[model samples]
Target: MGGRVSEPTTKASQFVVAILAKSGNIVTLYQLDVNNAFLYGDLHEEVNMTLPEGYFTENDKQTEGNMFISLFVYVDDIVITGNDIDEIKRVKTFLNSKFLIKYPGVLKYFLGVEVLRNDENICISQRKYCLELLNDYSMLGSKPANTPIDLGLCVVCSPSEKDNLLSNITKYQKLFGRLIYLTLTRPDISFVVQILSQHMHAPLQSHLNLSFRTLRYLKGSHGKGVRMVKGNELSLKAYCDADLGKCKLNTRSVTGYLVYFCNSLVSWKSKKQATISSSSAEAEYRAMGLTACEIIWIINLLRDLNINVKLHVELMCDNSSAIQIAAYFS
Candidate 1:
């Protein structure tokens, strides 16, 4: 018997790249599922073998020319989109010849994320996932909160006052893990989730309270999600900001960035800096550096997909000092 191996999967960012491309260009998005999908290698020497009960052989494709096909694969599930309809059909047929395939018309839902096509733009959300998360945690009836966390609240690792640790640490871990996944379509809660994730090892009661508050916040805007709009050009821009000494425990800065591809946000992150910054300007500079790295990666990704970015990538930093430093370094 031959052992089965997983297919070479594309990066998760490719999904965002596909969405951005579809919004800006004339392309059709489609989904495919391969029955008993498995990749096999050729035998070194010729060996005769009988077909096991029911078995068969199959095929694949790539992107080029006016015919552009962006394929994203996760195990057996596949998403295919391209500028040329004829090319897409040819590719689909080729795939079908090699393996049993299912054509699910357009890509409406995949991996829990709902894809909705509108006349003007494309909207992706996890509304069903959100509701299910709340229901699972018995938070469906919880009162809705206006914010994920209090604006002025300061979180510390060990509170001066006595605080109790959560008894069922696993429950808190599971809840936190779910919330982290929910951030895929809910960037609004990313910051709070990043903050709470630090205490996963042994969450305290206070941390649980904060996590519940985030759930309440999610309840208030469960329908909230990212929207991908068509852009006039494939230009890249980034916005970066940082809070000096934001982490109460380590005094480390918290930095965040949003990367926009042709006016549509393609990537974002909110996380604490690895090292402490001496000043606000330094923190902002560190944030800018992080954003620059992401922008470079995005540009390379676009280039790989045959999408050329014409203009210079822009980085917007609020701190004048940080900007000056960047200019000097350049």
Candidate 2:
């Protein structure tokens, strides 16, 4: 079928992590591989495809109904999670009967991210991926940087600096794409990656240098990852901030927010705003609005999963003027 096959959202990983944290030490995570998962998905639109080789539609029938075990599928890979061991086993057995499925006992590695589980906590990291990236750029042995970006470094769209343009545009684009993917588990470099991504279309030498500096920073903290510990509380808390006129060329402010479910860091974003704000208070208010929207979305998602979120979700902002503006507007 030429129709769109809706892939699982990238936030699936974060959600999985949050669930694991909520379950504490009693969680059971099963990794699965379906020989041809796409073929399993019930086609919404009529897809006329000549049977590939030996494959036939007669043998493959679609199954519908509510699944007891919670499953998240990303193309071929699937993560089956639940507390009820019998239910998990039953689902696995059913899938095996229908499709050629391989059940990996525990989720150690999936989507280039590694998972380490102990009695107390679960740790997620992309150490192997980070090392491979450094080696690809011949920066494995480079001195590590303490920070992703230099304290005084200012990156902007410099069209007049024609001589500073990167020689190979494709390479710059490729690096940026890889780094962006790396941010899935590496939130430490999220802000800098967001900044560099803005100039992917016309990357200058300064941009490339900053990207390298980010790589060096990754080298220093290659083993660092997010650790989700067992916690009794399932509180939803968010913190948001803004930098006024952070974008030197466009004069647009940057909004950054981090969200936590209980003590687990579930989501975060660092992006430049579309509209220009005249004052710092206005910028801060905009950031708050953006964060509130995210909170609402997350709350709805949790509700869908049957996890009740605390009615009063905490949203924290440091700016007094922004608080006043929000209170006034309310």
Candidate 3:
């Protein structure tokens, strides 16, 4: 059977890839697929098959059993995945010995995404996918912006913001959905995507214009991606900050926190806080506590990684009064 979307020689999606634990210190995640995974067993005795063109002169010696391998047909496609690479290679060899053989390498990218993995971390992104989206939306030629949301910009379209819904309003919503998926690797664009998504159900022309700010940012950050680092230092560290009263619509505080894997950013989020803080100290203290939870989770994940880490995480907050309050809580 033919493989999926990629060239047979270079891609490895025909087989499956997975990582498994070995000896607690070593992890072996092998990827292999049956070359013709479905064509594994010998054919049934009742089936008599004619030989293909040119193989036999009607005088070729017949094997004791049927000539066909087990055929599980799914529109002539096959898929196989297992922990043993040798068994996989053996299957490939057996198939090659019996019929035409072709295979690909480690399963990196499939469908539209490009996947890259290392001991430090795994990175998945769709730069190609986004470019396609941009080209489809005629945004490939638009000027690039450095940030997803401009600090100078404010949402002003309102009160009958309904009147100017884009004739292409659905297009605007579609791009928002794509961009929101992209935020999985780019939390830096979170606040922007979240803000634009607020208007997706009833997007106006002004709303549509404001949404492209993220696409502009994506244009510039074509190379930006997440990295999880493997490090000798195992202590969790978190940094939290707040821009007091940043939301223009309400006096809500925007809480931002960064969680690190060693020194690398693994998870971080920025969103408007739910409740109003009575004082700057209270806001800062709240940020520290939220980020502290992040630190604890990271520490536990590291333990799962078998790093044998301690729970001595530092939650950094700039407000001295907040720090003083933290000491009281501790």
In terms of lDDT, which candidate is strongest?
1
Question: Which candidate model has the greater lDDT, 1 or 3?
Answer: 1
Task: Report the lDDT tens digits of candidate 1 across residue range 1-330.
Answer: 111211267554557767777765567688998887655344487443323433433322222134456677878888987778888899999999988899888889877789887778888889999999999988899999999999988776874356777778998899988888878778899899989899888778899889999999999999988898887788988899999988887999999998888788788889999999999999999999999988877776676556788678889998999999999999
| Candidate 2 local Cα displacement, residue 135, angstroms | 1.1
Ranking by lDDT: 1, 2, 3
Candidate 3's C-alpha runs over 4 A off are 1-107, 110-113, 117-124, 160-170, 202-204
Candidate 3 local distance difference test against the native = 0.58
What candidate 1 gets wrong by more than 4 Å, as runs, is: 1-12, 36-64, 159-162
lDDT digits (tens) for residues 87-112 of candidate 3: 65666577568655444455354434
Candidate structures ordered by TM-score, highest first: 1, 2, 3
lDDT of 2 by residue, 14-36 (tens): 45544554356355677898886
lDDT of 3 at 240: 90
> For each candidate, what TM-score against the reference?
0.85, 0.85, 0.62
Report every candidate's CA lDDT: 0.81, 0.78, 0.58
List the pairs of residues colliding in candidate 1.
58-98, 59-98
